[model samples]
Target chain A: QKEVEQDPGPLSVPEGAIVSLNCTYSNSAFQYFMWYRQYSRKGPELLMYTYSSGNKEDGRFTAQVDKSSKYISLFIRDSQPSDSATYLCAMSAVTGGSYIPTFGRGTSLIVHP
Target chain B: DAGITQSPRHKVTETGTPVTLRCHQTENHRYMYWYRQDPGHGLRLIHYSYGVKDTDKGEVSDGYSVSRSKTEDFLLTLESATSSQTSVYFCAISELLAGGFHEQFFGPGTRLTVL
Candidate 1:
């Protein structure tokens, strides 16, 4: 099994709908969780990040992490068409004196107008 | 937009040819990384540097090599490019914060196609 697993979803939703994207991992040592948004032909951009298990709210986006279950999620409130992009989950732990992040396959989201 | 720029945003080369992708950052971050993105494989790390001339191989570093002679520049070289090496490549930099937490910023990707 991959270290990090995420559903490669072409999840389609209408405007103003709430969207939830999730990822699961097997590493218990992961302490840093991050969510990135990537558009077509562009590099991934850091959207939200959390230190450990908890919820962080940033305007229209919320990030949640559960250390016990090794699960992480990103919730988008009142999504808009401009929110269409691929969401990637990344996690890292301070191992061997450095942190090397592991990434999920990514979930594609499309907010229709 | 972390003051990062990747050159040759797009390129097409024949198999067995040598190819290099450059990642330049002005943020002066201590950590730099190289990654490749494919359709199903979101992004895979190729290599990373912690300081000038300090580097290490990543999961998919078999057919590739990286160099960091300066803090602002990191280069990924494909000795003999293969069709399998054709993919979009991204460079990222992270600065260590007070609490040891870091946030990485990426540059515009470089798309390479090998035929």
Candidate 2:
């Protein structure tokens, strides 16, 4: 099994709808969790970051991590058409003296007007 | 886009040819990474550099090598490209922050097509 698993969803939703994207990981040593948003033909940019098992909110985005279940979630409120992109979840532990992240297959999100 | 630039934004090469991608950063961050993105595989690290002249292999580093001769430049070279090496390549820079957190900033990707 892959270390991280995420649905490659072309999840279509209307503007102003609430969107929930999730990922499940099998590694228990992951202490840092991050969500990245990638636009078409562009590199991904960091959207949200959280440490361990907790929730962190930024604007319309909220990141939640549940270490016990090895699950992580990113919630988007008041989604907009401009928010259409691929969301990728990444986690990392301090291994070999470096924190190299392992990424999940991204979920594509489309918020239409 | 954080003071990072990748050269040859797009390229087409034949299999068995050697291809080199350049990543230049002005941020002077202590760490640099090379990754490739393919369909169904989000992003896989190929190599990373921790300091000048210091480099290490990543998860998928079999056919790849890297060099970091200066603080601001990291280069990834494919000894001999293959059809499987066709993918979008990205370079990211980061500095080790307090609490062992490293928030990476990526450059515009380089699209390489191996025919």
Candidate 3:
């Protein structure tokens, strides 16, 4: 099984709607979880990050991690056309030295105005 | 914007040619990573540097080699570029903060085409 799994969604939605993107991991050791957004032909930019198992909010973006269920999610409220990009989930285990990160296939999102 | 810079934003090289990509950072981070993005595979690690003169191989480091002579620079060299190596490359720097695996900041990607 893959260490991390995410839905590669080209999900299309209207502007102002809420969007939820999720990822699941097989390793319970992942203590650091992060979400990154990428535009076409561009490198990914960190969106939101959470430590251990809890919710972290930054402006219009929220990141949730449920260690018990091995699931992580990023919720964007009042989504805008500017949010149209690929969302990626990345996690790292404290045991694996302190640098190597495991990434999931990004979920593409498009918000139409 | 972690003060990371990647050179040669776009390049097209012939297959079997040697190509080297550079990642320069002003953050003085201890951890530097090299990754490539493709259609199905989101981002795969190619190589990483722990500190000056300290480097390690990643999952996809078979066709690549890296060096970190200084704290601010990391270089990834493709010995013999292949069509399979035609992908967008990204460089990242991780700070000691952010819970062991801090938010990794990325550079603007380098688009490479091996024809």
Off by over 4 Å in 1: none
| Best-performing candidate as measured by DockQ | 2
RMSD, one per candidate, in order: 1.1, 1.2, 1.3
Model 3, position A109: C-alpha lDDT score = 97
Better of 2 and 3 by DockQ: 2
Fraction of true interface contacts that also occur in model 3: 0.83
For all candidates in order, the CA lDDT equals 0.92, 0.93, 0.91
Model 1, position B72, has a per-residue lDDT of 96
lDDT of 1 by residue, A3-56 (tens): 999999999999999999999999898999999999887888889889988999
Better of 1 and 3 by lDDT: 1
Q: What share of the true interface contacts does each candidate keep?
A: 0.87, 0.90, 0.83
Candidate 1 pairs with clashing backbones:
none
For A1-113, candidate 2 gives per-residue lDDT tens digits of: 99999999999999999999999999998989999999999999999789889999999999999998999999999999999999999998866576588999999999999
Per-residue lDDT tens digits for candidate 1, residues B4-89, read 99988999999999999999998788889999989888899999999999999988998999999999999999999999999999
lDDT of 3 by residue, A14-47 (tens): 9999999999999888888989899887789888
lDDT of 2 at A66: 92
